[model samples]
Target: MTLDAALPALSSLLGDRLCRSKSELDHHGQSESHFPPTPPEAVAYPETTEEVAALVKICANHGVPVIGWGAGTSLEGHALAVQGGIVVDFARMDRIIAVNAEDMDVRVQPGITREALNEALRATGLFFPVDPGANASIGGMASTRASGTTAVRYGTMRDNVMGLEVVLADGRVIRTGTRARKSSSGYDLTGLFVGAEGTLGLITELTLKLRGQPSAISAAVCAFGEMDRAVAAVIETIQSGVPMARIEFVDAATARAVNAYSGADFPEKPHLLVEFHGSEIGVGEDAEIFRAIAEDNGAEGFEWARQTEDRTRLWKMRHEAYRAILASRPGARAIVTDVCVPISALAQAVSETQADIEASPVEAPILGHVGDGNFHAILLIDPDDTAEVHAAETLSARMAQRALRLGGTVTGEHGIGMGKLGYMAAEHGEGWQVMGSIKAALDPGNIMNPGKLVPPNNGAVG
Candidate 1:
């Protein structure tokens, strides 16, 4: 199994579509997060599923690694080509195949970004609701089982992705699920592959469930006296069954960072940015109820953005929170921590996490979709300072342990790429081994995506 042998066949098949230039290789190698660049030997741009199948067959023959690339926005180094092989970049395969407005679904190629899909669907009065803050590609979102602020209401990629056209490890194409919603047929292969993180196969197409555009949309930002109060408000809101469309939490440090980066005025206190979608009257009633709950939890400085421009500005600032946090510390890289606990345990979880960050030597800002008991602490550290990096790693490990201790998950949305592999055993134990067994069954050669989301094996070439 050698990349040298595979490149000749790939070049013969793709011609100029197969890229070996250093610039393209370096571009495909870079990650958005802190992982150092690990470039692939070559990058192949396949425009069709048949081409993808043929590419995989060629790689399988040579026993070379194949990694899929979408928009390259993943945080945990999900698409990095650590092993030197051919990276199947999906940039050319981006196309919205069909939109079945009557069925409230859309069939799309794997490379189309979420923003593009929504833009295409705007005229139909339907939209895909699984927004992960980033304009991430639908394929990448499904691969990660991603969910964000709207997931508290519309659910995650696991719920929105109705069907998938996947290319198996050995170049076979198969479709899972149907346009119709309900199914009792066979194993839930769609669900299995949704969060597999490319260890099993590569997703080529997706049929995503869409929701109707709401009549009235309302967004607001409310500040609390303390972090616990903001978290408590979220718990009470969920327990009260308010049906919130979105509810995100950001600590004081995060708010300050956003203020500095986005040029917006925000109180330097723990805040909950929330949104509601429904009929005009219904949305108003829900906001009233949420306001009452927040007030009960000692929330103050409540401000609503009722106009369309105001709402867009508010959410835009919230989506840019990660960059804002990074901007807080110049020349600092981040190790993002994603953890989710039961709604009832959220207050204690955030409290302990805030206390830990306070004690740490590095700056770690807390934020996330708290309505679903999911949150992140972006741990910033000087890349050159080994001691600072170690401190940040220790904080991340403790956060993972705390999430498990609180009966939650080590990863809420970010899958086990290269970052969170160590916590898999602690989180899933025997089940983790079962995942490896399934991987072996689907991809015996381990060429799909080596050294990710499964147990270690000799076939790993990275």
Candidate 2:
């Protein structure tokens, strides 16, 4: 039951694959964002499914917490080891087991990053489209159920991840889902494990649905007169049923930050960056419709980039938005607020949130995936300043409440980790208790990535 005892056994089983050095602990402990650091007792590099199973079995026998770490790019602290245990770093597990080009599905290990997968598939003229900006591991993305800009068209991890191989808390290996697209099978365990965030099980492999690379892809940018007008443009575009590949929003502050940081000369105004993917004529038709919608909402400077290099530059700035916001204000940390609201409520939600940021002490910059009615306000704060932290946290809590009120969710792409634990009760209500019940049923000993997603309160510890 003690970590000291578990470490030696894991070391023997994994040989040099198991790491206990202080440097490994420190690296695995840190995350991309502002959450406080929490180092695991040890880090294990499991190269195969069997290795992961053995590691999990050992940890379960001793009742030691087991943290599954991927690229460590999660924003909600899903990869942290707050309970202190073995960190299973999935780096060595990065392998593509199979690419069923005929079926348009690929099977890959948990540690394979998105960029790597896409690179491997480049010659196949097919791509996996669940992009969370960061080059996160496929396993980590499945655990968090991540969605990003491309999710509007291609769907999120929850949809693209057709099947999974999960190592449950009790060291049971199970496969959920099948190679076929749909099924009426029992329990739907694949769906259950996708967004569980490692609280219930560790995902070892994923069978992801792939899309044929569009023959004609066009990226465009349009600036709106105001934030509400910009949101209205997005709503109108989606309502028109335009199959946009991606539709992302960048507010004035966020645009300004990127413009300064990335040396792009875009106007400091609310802009909608979008991509259209399809056949030559199909993409052109959607582009025409999208441009008209934006113009109706008073959008200005409507421009499209057809060249691949130009499109890359446009998305590069967008992907670095979080870092740009941090760099905009030197020495300032950020509390990134994520909220997904109903489309009808988006304009109002964003307008009021903009006002709230102006009124509050925290400096917030707004951006989002507007096609999904999910947006974020990156609130800059001084982690050392208690007052600033409280102010930012208070504003984030308000946004969560507002999202629930609008019949959305506390997190749209980022899974509920420790940061959003406070809003679980508000978002799920009695359903929150239901989640805890499921958690207890699967991980009764509370040994799998404790203190995240499910808070382990309610019926979890009777």
Candidate 3:
């Protein structure tokens, strides 16, 4: 498919909906993380499911690649159209179809952001709990299976997304799962597509599970003398079964970086920022149990944020921790990779990773949703320095392999976009090949987002 030839037909089909301007292409090409800008031939804004289906159909006829674009917050280049096709920007599809407060679910367009949905649910005493800190579109979140601090209790996109309206590569519209809860159902296609990274189909609409706002919420930070102690505290808390709403780990370096950037001061040491949400008594009990665990692990310098405003400020700072890290080092890009392991192996993993980082030249900051055994090392890089980029990638790859050895995944929430595609075979082995077969079945022409997720016929795509 000569991409230039397809663009004229795409423009004809989409009319003003098609974008090919330099600025628009540049904007769509870029990503939040360190991947180099790779733009598509054009960007398409589809307002409705039928619009998306029609767009896909046109692309299919021309053997043109189609990439799904959401809020463009993907850290792993999942939204980037590297092969140069039509980028279906879903921003114009922002709308809430229905909000069933009693059913505890909402029907929304792919572009409806998590923050917007929460705002609508404000008076209803219910909120969607999947907070990736980016205010990512619900569709994008589902595509990448993003989970943030609150995932310990509320679950990831895989759990919250009850159903999805997807346009197949050939423009066939299919609805997977249902608004009603749990179904033995058929082949579990919904699970397959939730984290497919848009290689199989374009997610147009989503039915999301909602959580009731807890009656009593408490947020606090506990600092430990050492990273080992802080990690131990997390393990103990989880093992003791407090059902933590959010439990995050920030290494001393990360704490210093975020504090410098966010202007929140504390003793610069390994720390845990935790939240408890439940009935008044239940939250109190969970906090008590957590306090005991922290003290046992030699945690000190504990600070409590009791008021709602104070709690929000605390969490907001934590969410912006990534920005803070980038600010600490002027003129540096980041290579961020997420890996999750068994809870029992978290301490070893963190210790080994910290050691590896300290031994390396790259300035790496460690942080994670510790309760879920998921963490990331944000390796600061100088884009102009090829050596620095390679070093950072080496560190990320080593840690990913280590996580797999511990019976973990290369990416816990961040889906296998372009970056982690290499590790798919190592993590899934034969099952990874099975995934490619599924992709072949769904997208025979490979007209969907190319150079991502599934491998080629014989071996790895890379």
Candidate 4:
């Protein structure tokens, strides 16, 4: 039951693939957000599912923790090896196994990034649409159940991932779901592992749903004088069934930061960056309907992007909004948090959250996919300043509570890692205990990404 003992076996199994270098350890230890560094004792790169299963068996026999790593873009520290054993990185197993163009599905290895998958599919006239704005690996995106701008139309990983090949805690390799679209299957095992964040198993391969490239694409940005109006416009747009391909909201603070960073002249007002996809006529009609709704809600400065480069610029700015906000303040780390509430309560939730942030001392920029009732706050804080950190923490906690109070989740897309563990009980109640029981049933040794997702437990199997 010793990690030190397990390393030699892993090294023998992987040779140079098992890395213990300080630089690699330090890199894997860090996170994109504010969580402290918690690196694993070693990092193992397995190029095949069989290798992963063997490595897991070795670690399980030694009572060692096993954490999964994809592209390392998760904001929730989902991949950090907190319990200190081995981090199984899936960077090399990135191959598109098959692309069923007629059936419109693709089977891929877990390590392929969304961007790479789409690039490979470009000639097929079909594409994957679950973009989380980071070119994140499909495995990491599925692990966190991630969604971003296009989620309003094409849905999240839960909808796009048709099946998975998983390496369980005790080293059993199994496949869940199938290429067939519908089934009366016994259990939704694929659903179970998709968002489990590698607690139950490590994902080795995935069969994903694909959508055809849109015949026509149009994007636009409109400004609203007030945040409430901007939110109200989003609510109405969703309710009216505009079928928006992507609808994102950015507050004045975000607009200011984006303007400064991207060198685009966006008036310092709350803005909705939107896109529509369909037939040429259909997209035009949808854009017009949305424009009417936005204008009715007091939107101004209606700027449209029809050409490829212009629309790319518009979305590029939206996708890079996080870095832009970070650039607005030098020497600052962020506590990036998000929540999803019912579309009806979105205005109230956003308004109250804005008030709370304004009253606090730290500067936090607000943005998200408002069309799906999800939004994010990037709370910029000087990590060295304890008071600023505390203030940001308080704001984040309050936001989680507010989401729950309004019939929502503590995290809309960002899964529970070390950052959001405190609010799990409040959100799930006894249901949280059921999750722990399930974890115990599946991973009795608690070696699969110990200290995450399910309730905490001593990582000991007796």
Off by over 4 Å in 4: 458-462
Task: List runs of model 3 lying over 4 Å from the truth.
Answer: 7-9, 457-462
| The 10-residue segment with the lowest total lDDT in model 4 | 453-462
Q: Best lDDT goes to which candidate?
A: 4
lDDT by residue for model 3 (1-462), tens:
666766666677678988889999999999987889998888898888888898888888778889998899788898888777889999999999998999999899989899998998899999999998888998999999889999999999998998889999888999999887878868888888898999889999898899899999998998989999999999989998888999999999888988898888968898899999999999988898899889988988788887999999998988898999999999898888799999999999999999999888899999999999999999999999988888898899899999999999999888878888899898888998898888887788887888888785433221
Clashes within 3 Å, all models in order = 0, 0, 0, 0
Q: What stretches of model 2 exceed 4 Å from their correct place?
A: 457-462
| Selected candidate, larger lDDT, 1 vs 3 | 1
State the displacement of the C-alpha of residue 313, model 3, in Å, after optimal TM-score superposition.
Answer: 0.7
| C-alpha lDDT values of all predictions | 0.91, 0.89, 0.89, 0.92
RMSD of each: 1.2, 1.2, 1.7, 1.1
- Among residues 3 or more apart in sequence or in different chains, the pairs in candidate 3 whose N, CA or C atoms overlap within 3 Å are none
TM-score of predicted structure 4: 0.99
In candidate 4, list every pair of residues with a backbone clash.
Answer: none
Q: Which wins on lDDT, candidate 3 or candidate 4?
A: 4
Q: Between candidates 2 and 3, name the one with more favorable TM-score.
A: 2
Q: Give all TM-scores, in the order shown.
A: 0.98, 0.98, 0.97, 0.99
Per residue, candidate 1 scores C-alpha lDDT tens digits across 125-144 of 99999989898888888999
Residue 12's lDDT in candidate 2: 83
